[model samples]
Target: MPLITLQNVDYSIGGPLLLDNVELSIEPGERIALIGRNGAGKSTLLKLLSGDLRPDDGEVRVEGGVRVSRLEQEVPHGAEGDVFDVVAAGMGELGTWLAEYHHLSHAEHVDTDKLAAVQARIEAANGWSADQRVVETLTRLDLDGEQDFTGLSGGMKRRVLLARALVSAPDVLLLDEPTNHLDIEAIDWLEGFLKAWPGALVFITHDRRFLRALATRIVEIDRGQVTSWPGDWANYERRREERLNAEAQENARFDKLLAQEEVWIRQGIKARRVRDEGRVRRLKAMRVERAQRREQQGNVRMAVALGESSGKKVVEAREVSFDYGGKPMLKALDVTIMRGDRIGLIGPNGSGKTTLIKVLLGELAPTSGEVRLGTNLQVAYFDQYRATLREDWNALENVAEGRDFVEINGKRKHAIGYLQDFLFTPERARAPITRLSGGERNRLLLAKLFAQPSNLLVMDEPTNDLDVETLELLEELLGEYEGTLLLVSHDRDFLDNVVTSTLVMEGDGRVGEYVGGYSDWLRQAGPGQVIAGGGRGAAGVRNAAGVAQDTSSTASGGTGNAAAAAPQATAATAGNASAAPKRKLSYKDARELELLPARIEQLEATLEALAGEMNEPAFYQRDAAAIAAHGSRLGETQQALDAAYARWAELDG
Candidate 1:
């Protein structure tokens, strides 16, 4: 039986129908990617499934005793707990028992029998090492367990909430934009974690790579209905396109018939016959249908016109180094940026990607070395934090602030006219900034930024909170942009689509330049590939294939591949080796590595059996405490298995 089902579900907020008579069923082990345009009720549907919201009409049913967990887009207000407390809350009844056990163990004059009973209960509930598991999860997400929730940044808080939802190991997990604040490594880790999940998983994300890698089914919320497609994001896109094309053709035929009917009605009949009356009614219905079709076909077009060209050398950084409080962030980085170069800056959070951008833009002076900007280098930067926007102003005022008109392609265009190009209607442009959806606000910011012409465009995290449609439009605009582009984004697909080269920041003050995109960089930096300088070669010159290119030749305008210098070996190995010896593994390490696969398989089988038992109708009728204990044990085992796999990967690498 399906774990959860939504039957004839209808929901609305203040006015328009968001979901109308939507039906859906989620089966075990199904990974569903919920996708839609902004404001398309994807979040609403997830809320309904998670029981966080009730539908105005129809029923949402869950199988008996099925557990559900959700990760909301916004962190709840007034959460006073620290990271550990918040994540542990997901443990539910098991957490209660664990707390009691701790209290009992510490109390003076405690009953010895009671203490022994509580100890057994702790073992049964898998609460013995719960704290360790929680800490591990926090570390993996780059969060500190002791950090106060109130003091955490918006992105950090979001990660905490995500960790909570994950630690719960629910039968059905509903996530809304789980990747919003995550870096590339965290996202990659989440992909692997979700793929190994044994329960029903449904999530909303704009990351194309995430959807393609994890989604077994795609559920799109469109036109007040939910449509399901089998397979990954690529399959869904192809099918959706075909479906839309067919609908467009059918609408064309309907329009022709309606036109004929209108002409016949204009001919003026003396008495209205039954057949004529029927044709008139059909024509009216066809008109309504056409209007709806037009609404469904709403598409936004984004265009960027290049401004005056800068010099051939747009930016040049020579041996740049930056440090914060004597801690090196960037060390001796040399890079040349030419006009029309599309470069993507990528690194983990707090790895100095932003600092490098500042150094290049001359916003911050490097501790050592120099930066040179070419003549007539008009730079327009889009801040990821949206710091330039005025909250008191409406969308129109925000975009049109400080000017009656803006110049685009050497033509003077009115402010409102420029706003219209970003899909903001006159009415919507008058709406307050607070009333706009995240995507709308982002679009408004883009409208304001792109209005002025610039030879160099710098954007940081531009894809955050943007719907897939808008993301695609932005990608298209960037592709056609005839200017120097410097972007920092975590979206792998977006980087692959828009950037020609990537600048990777490997922590501890090492930065590398690789030609092509993020994927190309990953391929070249894959396991067992030796890193030259801290993590990259000197001068950091790499070809499209990510092999080190001769920096001397490139600087002289010659295209030639440079052989990398080999590492020197110690005397013992260098003198007597017929072949380089492999690194010897300890006995315990070797045994564990050999047994990990079978152990993982055994754990998976055990987990599946536990889930089967918990789902049985009789399970709920049994002792509630016993059921809780089994569930907690299952969660613990899963965590253990995940750790084992992670360790194996690390050792193998």
Candidate 2:
């Protein structure tokens, strides 16, 4: 059954359409992902669906008596009750009724009127004991115990709220950025819960993995129009690519048509001196058609520019340790960031990725270590919120407020003009900062940041609210940036596509360095099968005879000429004694290292193919299995790469 329907809904603020003529009907058991760039009215639509707001020119109807609940991004943790009570409130009317029924059961309620009223209330609310529901929900959400939820951290508080919403068992669950504060373990728990959920769900989130894990359908809001895609996030991405390609083809065809029209217009005007009224009329008609064709929207382009800088180590930390309110976050960390290095600072959420960045920026002092900065380093920091602009200030004023710029080429251009290059139009330039969407504010801040010629950039969660297009632009900018970058983000695509190396802060407050992207780091440091005897037993390794093997061959005496003496081949492959013959890997061992690249390419292709299928509607019901398979395959490929890398390192290092 359709739980809710929006008929020609049009929402506006300050006379500008926020959502235009959006017609959508959501039924029970639909797990929908509401996706858009920041400021595309995704949250606004959720508000309207939740009955907290009304559309100016449309009707929103709820089917039957279906209830809706929204789990807000910023949860209120008042100084009132314990976390248990707070989460129990998600049960709404059922909870209230359960509490009243309990009171009636405990009291001496012999009065017939009181009994009838209590029974009526329970029946009206569908008569489920909220206490039992709360317990069940809390357990499923991993918030069952008092130890976990009562005296909690910020990350744990987020989990409690999510548990509360699930406990309510509403017809529709509306979640806004629910994964923002959760750690890896909690996120995994939530993912499993959502996978098994039986009700309708509409969630807006920045966690790509979470969205890919749970969303069965995707609804994208662009400009003011909502378009629905029938599969998961990856499917939406594929369809978006198809649409863009089609648009590009259509645009090319339109341009050719316009060129023909232009030639006709020129000739018609030239002949107008001797032509009749019909010729002029025909030219005008062609002109109108050309104008209509030219009405196609232009692509949004963003370019980031960085000034030249001396090639030097911009920031270095030696034995650095940090603590917050006496709890150690980062300990004995040694790191060096050089110019032009694109470094990813990754960890489970709350594992001090941000804290480490803050330490480097000198915003937070290290408890016990030295942080050295290059003499000529000019660092620009992008905060997580990127909401530093004043609410009342326009874009131009916001950009130029405290910065000083000199005239160039005898022309004085305000900071606003510079912003126009980043796609902030004249009308949007004067709009108040508060009216801008999250993505807009991020762009505005980025524009302001790049306008300054900073050599070292420290970005904290830079990809948080950015759309895929904007993120790609940022990736291109970072790729071409001449300065150093230290970015902290949970976005896997961002880390894998943008960064070259990673600095991971582990759960034990220790930091480690890895030579590649996030997935690479995860394979090397995360729990995986590591071959003994220096990558010898690892998968994908081969012997000289073209047999598939691992680095463990050297230890197991497997890499040898089948006719040659096993003891002799083992000794040759193992020791490097000064008096002994220079030990060499037999044909098999040598071939194993040589085949690493081909194996890596094969794994990459496998991952891509599996990712494509993971988004198919056929796999939505098997999301858990699909995710597990993908994760397993990813882990395997990463491990194989690691083993190959280790073998290569031994030879090259």
Candidate 3:
């Protein structure tokens, strides 16, 4: 009855068994999220489901003729051709013929004879439906069919492969970290697209937001066992906590009993009696059980090393412009980045996030305009490329920098000791980085970066490949970091948690600064678009009290508060306005404006109270109906406050 089933499966590479007596099943129409700590065999389980790997023991069964497709974490090397050909290749032999036909038909040098022959083969094989599906998938993913696949960015290549997997129309789709290289826009789109898809989804991801949005069922791999958790992400968290606590208590009881048995068995005279022979056998079995037990993995102990304070102003830009490939990447940007400001940069892939970071940090010169950095700034940068790491060195060598010890916050710690805090054993720490997993590499990079203190921290796409626990720990670290942070991440939850303000690359080299993080930007800028440079809306990034609440750097000509600015400008240009004979406010209108401030304050207090209640963990545990009602009320109250702000601005102007 299941789409795929694994029964009493045992698998391992060399040492310890990666999976032991694992039993799991995939049902049609289920969105099962496979989650675990790094090296817990999540990907290995996916391969077993896809029939890419055979279990050493037990049976894996699939319903007759059900197709399975996979999107791997790493892009396959040497993938070639335009997007269409690569995607169509997912359909096997029929796909090959259709792809050949497509390339021949679209070539600059027309190959009519070859095209016709390939077309005849495709028709004979009845592959036209697969052909249409390929085109449709490309369009859905916003991939250009004629574009060269090898030339695409890593993020784009991932998308193309995803398209290829989707074009197969498999009943089961296994995606490993599907959100890995995608930008926020692509992530949002993928969430929506996957929700609309009809096939069963078994995905492994570290994106909490994406998991919360798409997972209909939760499955986790711990030790060597696969488990299915009931309910949503919130429910899973609560349930998992309960399970772990119970396991700990049970293990304690078992150990206590085992200790008593050992003491009894040590008696010199009574232990050898014939009457105690059964007791001796039972004790021997208990020893085997204890030896076979697997302990829980230790958590990553993360801490940030902060540097001395810098000048109040961190970096300031005036009419900054950058151009590459004869096109403007940044244009006329004015921003004053002050100390301790946590800023998030969001844009599509190839939208110049890295370049903008470089230009602002004075690492790369802008094609036009000026940037000034504050004095005494100790900057620590986390490159998304991990370029700072020498591939030739292992974790210890990389973090040590030719010394056995590293100083953290004026305290010296051995390099191996520090790596241990990140969950690396001495063996792993000394092993070449090429043998480490993606998550391990990310952890190593963090270890390297945090070894030294810095007044300014710049991280680009720092959330990729990290386990959920490690990711959350890093977020907690960044939250407490006493320094300016420039974070470039597509992770919605991470951005929301770490950044107080955002600078969005809207388009055409224009950057828009708004108060708050990704969700705030969404509420202000709508779903797919961003606020244009220097533009302020009535409710753009509004906080409690219906006032614009953003501490981000303002671009040139941008106004933070139009309501406050209108009155000041009016008084400053009184002479010019006198000749114009400005229209006067009616008595009723003036009275309304006078009362608006108090009304706005009341609404703000109500909004704050509601938000505070919802922010608590227990609030989300409430019934769905109650939570939905509160959310609806909050939205209504926000709308009313925004309307009041708009009215006040109109009267003042």
Best candidate, TM-score: 3
Candidate 3 structure lDDT = 0.81
- How far is each candidate from the true structure, as Cα RMSD in Å? 14.5, 11.7, 7.9
lDDT (Cα, tens digit) per residue for candidate 3, span 235-273: 677688889999999999999999998988887775556
Find the candidate with the highest lDDT and give its number. Answer: 3
Instruction: List TM-scores for all candidates, in order.
Output: 0.76, 0.68, 0.83
Order of the predicted models by lDDT, top scorer first: 3, 1, 2
Worst 10 residues of 2 by lDDT: 540-549
| Clash numbers, per candidate | 0, 9, 0
lDDT of each: 0.74, 0.66, 0.81
lDDT of 1: 0.74
lDDT of 1 by residue, 617-638 (tens): 3553444346446646665665
Number of clashing residue pairs, candidate 3? 0
- Give me the displacement of residue 400 in model 1, in angstroms: 0.9
